[model samples]
Target chain A: MSSKPESDHDVVVAGGGAGGIGAALGAAKAGARVLLVEKYGFLGGAATSSNVLAYCGFYKQGPEPVKVVGGVADLVLDEIKGLGLGCEPFRSPTTDNWIILLEPETVKLALDRVLDAHGVQVLLHTRVAAVSRTADRLQAVTLAGMEGRWRVAAEAFVDATGDANLALIAGLPCRTGDDAGYLQAATGPIRVGGRDRSVPIDRARIVAAFKEYNWTGAHPTARQDGGIFAEVPVAGDMWWMMYDHELVDLTSKSFTQAEMAARSAAGDYVKVLRERVPGFENAFLLQTGPQIGIRESRHPPARYELTGEDLLSGRRRPDGIARAAWPMEDHSVPGRPVYRSIGGEGFADIPLDCLRALGLENLYYAGRTIGADAAAYASIRVMGTAFATGEAAGTAAAGPDDRIEGTAT
Target chain B: MWRKSGRFQSLAHATAGEMPAKRSCPGISRDIALLLLFATDDLAAESVAGTCNSEAVSHHGLERDFCSSVILSLPIPIMCGAISAIQGHVLGLRR
Candidate 1:
């Protein structure tokens, strides 16, 4: 497609993942003109083009199946239900390995429909190169696309980039990893299918074998139905696998490098999958994603820094915006992805104060990019909570008032 | 960024999701969301020097002033922390 000239809009969104799509939809729904810039041809980020199989962190556990990530969270579920997407949220870590089984094409259409209804201008195959700001107030955004270069001006901007690319470009405060620069492992999700649907994955043997044999296949490995593995709903039979690799940096601004490394890493991971999974006697590799699934990035400075206590306690803030039930999962060492259940008592609520970017007026955060501790993020970075955060942030950013609450601490 | 654990939501976007309209801070809203979008404009020191110390805000000392003003000004985000009261008095926000 050909590129158009620079333009002006009311809100400019820089990411196309679950968060960016939510922000664009929310802002546009609130009567704001919006422009969406994405580097990929599709909008679902890791979910679609990246081929992530399942949606994460959307439901609360136990018999009733309570969920705090309502709003967009519910919408994703309903959207899939509308399409008759066949997949259920995992009853446990091994059953189906996903909370919401979203078909990538369905999400693409859903995103398109939402943007169309709200009249959000979407620039696919586009990348945000630099931010144009004046003394901390963003003026416009410089973009690179078919036309070579163009600018997008907006009254409000959202950094939905999972990598928090906009914030880094604008010189905003952001962080990565712990004091030792120990970031979480990012995976290149690949989809392999044509398996016998009737064949129940031998989760016990693969996991037990990994434990007993310490199988090394030159890549991190996991049983399709093991404690690891998230799902994506797509046509034919396909599964999105997220294995671990710590050194690969998905946060880098260079698109080419990030894309290349992620693909390569996924390639390596798949080689191990063939060597590892018990059902792979005939499993065919379908697709591998370009972007590495990001675990942590820059957080917002707001009312409070969510702690392990709050998560485990299932604590709800008066300003609580949403809740998460996903366990604290990490794939750093690859022996066994760290799974820290938040207290195992109840679900936790994230306060609205958590989304406020302290110094920037009207600037909002959602998804994995919000400010959080190394430990705190591992718990809330699920796509389910991300949807809730996006809905709240988008609505909050477009609220009828600009009243900020006073700091308690 | 993405550290892990649970995540909070948005209310700071506006009063009950209202912004670019009502600029009033109301009661003690336990809002803690920061989407962190910077305009090629370096508006304020929302965080400390580097990403290392998140608890230490980039408030650049004016956090108190803004907090007080927000407490007194309006009922937008009542009961929440505001970045700065005296807008121009900010340090790092000035590009």
Candidate 2:
């Protein structure tokens, strides 16, 4: 109507992960016309496609006490439950809900249905190649898809790319690194069947092997948890092994190295599972994750940087959006223990302030791109919490705001 | 106080109390299977030690027309530890 050929929407959400769904749905529900751009043909990104094995933090409620990550999160979960999807129950202490086993095709169709029902405009097989901005506000996003290159205009934008790919391209200040500038090892989640669960611990044999090999840190099935791997079964027959570290940098060298490292690490993971984990002895690797799990990346600049202290104190900011309870699960890339934080029996709530991308007006981030210090990033980066954060961020983006709450305006 | 109906049975107790259900066994149910996606925080730490299960999400999201609701229990620490740790970690130090 305005003589502009570009597609128009009040809110444009990039990425099709759990957070993207929540953001799009929230904006739509708040009466904002939304356009959801996904690089893949389907939604659910790492969640359903990657066969993530479990829902990390979608809600604090179900038949159990999982968080109520309302909006689209609840919508997706409903479909999973109603359809008898492959979702299975996890035994986290606070919640007792099913982690969808992630049958990729089923999830894709279901997510499509959910989005269509919500009246969201969908652009699949499209990747956002560039962003157009005016001063501090975003104007349009140019994406490359099969139909040819096109532009989408929006008043507000939500960068839900798990790695914040678009925001980083838009020149937003972000951070990515680990203790040694080496991120946690990423694993290709494999789905194998016919695992020999009845295999005895063979404590003597394993201890003998450990003693002989002197494999302390960064080996298969050799955990620093004193041989207590009870929670590993949360994945059902499917299990994961850390393969390679995804180094997040824009240089061409980074890309080549990342791909090679991922493949090499993945190959090593398969070998270790074959040689180490007892139940996995008969298990051949079935599949690798579609999305290589990214533990650290360009954390979008926000109004507040969630810190390790916030996690320790359990401080609930007035503008709190959702909650997180996973530990600082730092993956050690060989030569050391994948040191988990000194965990405590407490939970952290994500404040609304954490959603605001710094120095940018009307543009926010979700998923692993939100503003959090490196230490706090480990815990807040769970899938369930990512969904919740997106839910809240979407809701906030949908609603009108004078200034970001919980921080200096 | 409400009992989950017809989901499954407990294999063993964890720490002389309720044991976290193991998925490897057939004992796990559909509703319980869904809880891995959620966590509850409204109740005070001492008020309820119940784990928030995804049964509700799955029941309402995907299985509303097909799967049945299940009954189960898990340690409350997964939420508490996760929530508490994140909260403590975020609030304790400067971002």
Candidate 3:
């Protein structure tokens, strides 16, 4: 074995999604030499790749919208606002929660600028091929990219891969879905342009027409859904359409089939919109998401598992590091989603233990893969909550001996 | 029973197809009841805000007047009709 450390860094973060970006930024800001590795060529993972343009869970939902998370999340929003690439937070007509809509292309540039400013080294088009561990501590992670195989050795590691890929590879115990392993449905949001801004299309009519045409794909009930269930206007005459891909496994074959299915569905949906829906007479498809959006997959076991009961009860831990204001939006069922309000102040605190893998000393995780049961995961897996958790993980990982105050259970 | 709300009444009128008859399943009704409880609480608090005329403001400097106008004029049920759709699948253990 080679004696030299393989490309040393203070912190290494896998996955370039919201959580990964947060981890990289947080570590860098905390005075650590950080490296962020992403499978895509660009920065924003789900936001850019999956065309998930809206940032949810940023604010408490009720009669009045209240901002709950600040710090790195604020920096990202401010940068996007300064660049004039995002929309001010507006109340969602369906959920009544405040959401920030962004231009996907601009978001890529915004993330790039933020990471560059923080001196975080980014490796795009790179994925974690293997992980090396000595007993309970992770030593190095081997990366595979166009440049071929290379190893990165770091003092701490953050598994922000959305699927807990790093932790699973490191031989840590992880869970998926519930005890039954049922994951929430995936979506591939498509961009549509040339929509008539002067006239509003009737969504009910569109859905009815889609059903009449018998193009429901895997979701036969495409009539009763309520979770961000319609096309959102991103810019003038442009909108992002969210379409369901139903239950898809985390396999390449399933992903390929899902992509083809989404593209075909987008085409059909657009055709119906132009033909049946009045305002969309001239609407055309711009592009489908670069990849299918996976809502849930593998969740690494943490020191403490946040459960649905916790969210419903509005449980707050003394070591809470962030707040999730979104409701329990379970998209596991087809048609309408199951939404349970956060019982207390309309927000639930996420403790630091959720980010630390139970058996591993230096391994951490954030984003959708954080330790949570199905319902609780749905509430906190939104992009905004992911940012908060990622920031906490990065901050904790960079601290001495992971001794982040207020994080102890 | 839920149709007593002005929003559901408006939703019933707006959609062209027959609305699914009041769901009789106990589990589904319970879930719907819980959701409605939250919805009604917010609606009651928000009624004083004047007919949901809030504009759909885009931070990117684009005006969504059409969307804002629709949201303002439509009743809660109509808005829900516009937002809800049916997709296949149910939350269960992975088959």
Candidate 4:
């Protein structure tokens, strides 16, 4: 691939995670010439690359689960199910939250098909190195990838980079973590297979064995409540194990170290499982995620900063673009995780203003990079919510100013 | 933030599965109990400062603006006492 002149498009989406996919598909459906740029070859960001195989935030809390997230998110789930690659909603024994289990490979394929059907052009293995902005509006983005550096112009831009990379590069205001900059812990998931198909997993026995083997990195909440563990059965006899790498810096140097540490920790966990746990005698390690899963990072200033109070109160907005039903799942601490219920039958509304960057008129953001307090971010950062935000941003970015309802709050 | 207050901090820490020592505050406890007893259904705050603003006109036909006014019009101490009372109730603390 060679660098080309300033190519133009209606909406240029940076990052190809759930948000980016949703944005691209939404923009294309709105009849916009859309271009999606991703740093990796695959479509799903943490869902595929980091092997976070569970999709949450789609249903309301309480005994009777109500599906709140619709639109593109519902479409994705339906498509995955239609392909026979998705499992029925797995209701947590402790939290009563419903998590839809997905196969990463199938998810990627479904996303590819969706984007293709919607006529969204995708550029894989592409990274946005620099952004060009004229005052409050983003003009173009300079991308650096395997081929070379290239500049692409767009009428509007969507930053779904998970870290708000494009917004930061454009000199836009963004906040990371708290005033103390304490971010959530990261995890590198590992896939294991060849376990006994009929054997039931005993949570108590697993916790006891983990303690006996001195597995320090295992989440204490998972050991106690038996639901915080990222491990979920993906396909027949295969499970995705999300081992936490606590308090990791997202920089290249620290990321490399975290990956190495996670790999070692995962190996140790596998050994303990095979030796101590039942039905794991013939278990084998399948694969580790290509990248470590980041739970929290830079949050760009948006029109409305969703707060914990709003989520807990189950606030609803007329201009709401998405509904977040997941609890405040704080993975900030390694062992002691915090899970606060949203406390209502109806879901928490994600207002449209949260998707728009505070000082930028044309630049929008979705996924983990959207403006929110630390506690609110924990609940809305799930894949289902990410897709809804992405769809909202993409829809607003496709047309003229008439589409967006309100000004910055 | 209310969460940073010493009182609320203790409450939050307790909710995180911690066991906090019992502290007695009869005056505050009485005020909270009165507020809870007299608090009308209309005294529900819709949007506070630093919280996401809701555009909901009403809940079951009850005006949200009236709710906001009712909550905001209350005395500061009463509001604090009410919050503390609710926190204590959630945490299952008697005092």
DockQ for each numbered candidate: 0.06, 0.02, 0.01, 0.01
Q: Pick the candidate with the highest DockQ.
A: 1
lDDT tens readout by residue for model 2, B27-66? 6543333332222232234422122222323323544322
**Weakest 10 consecutive residues of candidate 1 chain A by summed lDDT:** A400-409
Model 4, A14-35: lDDT tens digits are 9999889878876775568899
Docking tier of model 4: it is: incorrect
The sequence of per-residue lDDT tens digits that candidate 3 reaches over residues A213-271 is 66544433353321243345445544444466666466788778878887887787677
Cα-based lDDT for every prediction: 0.57, 0.56, 0.68, 0.68
- Where in model 3 is the C-alpha error above 4 Å? A1-5, A215-221, A225-234, A240-242, A402-409, B1-95
The 10-residue segment of model 1 chain B with minimum total lDDT is B32-41
Model 4 has an lDDT value of 0.68
- Name the regions of candidate 2 deviating beyond 4 angstroms: A1-4, A58-68, A86-88, A92-103, A178-182, A194-237, A242-252, A255-258, A261-282, A332-345, A402-409, B1-95
Residue A313 displacement (Å), model 2: 0.3
Clashes of each: 91, 109, 16, 0
Residue A139 miss distance in model 3 (angstroms): 0.5
DockQ-based class of model 3: incorrect
Candidate 1, residue A213: lDDT: 34
| Candidate 3 vs. true structure, TM-score | 0.76
Per-residue lDDT tens digits for candidate 3, residues B7-71, read 23222211111123223112323222222221211122233223222221221122345433443
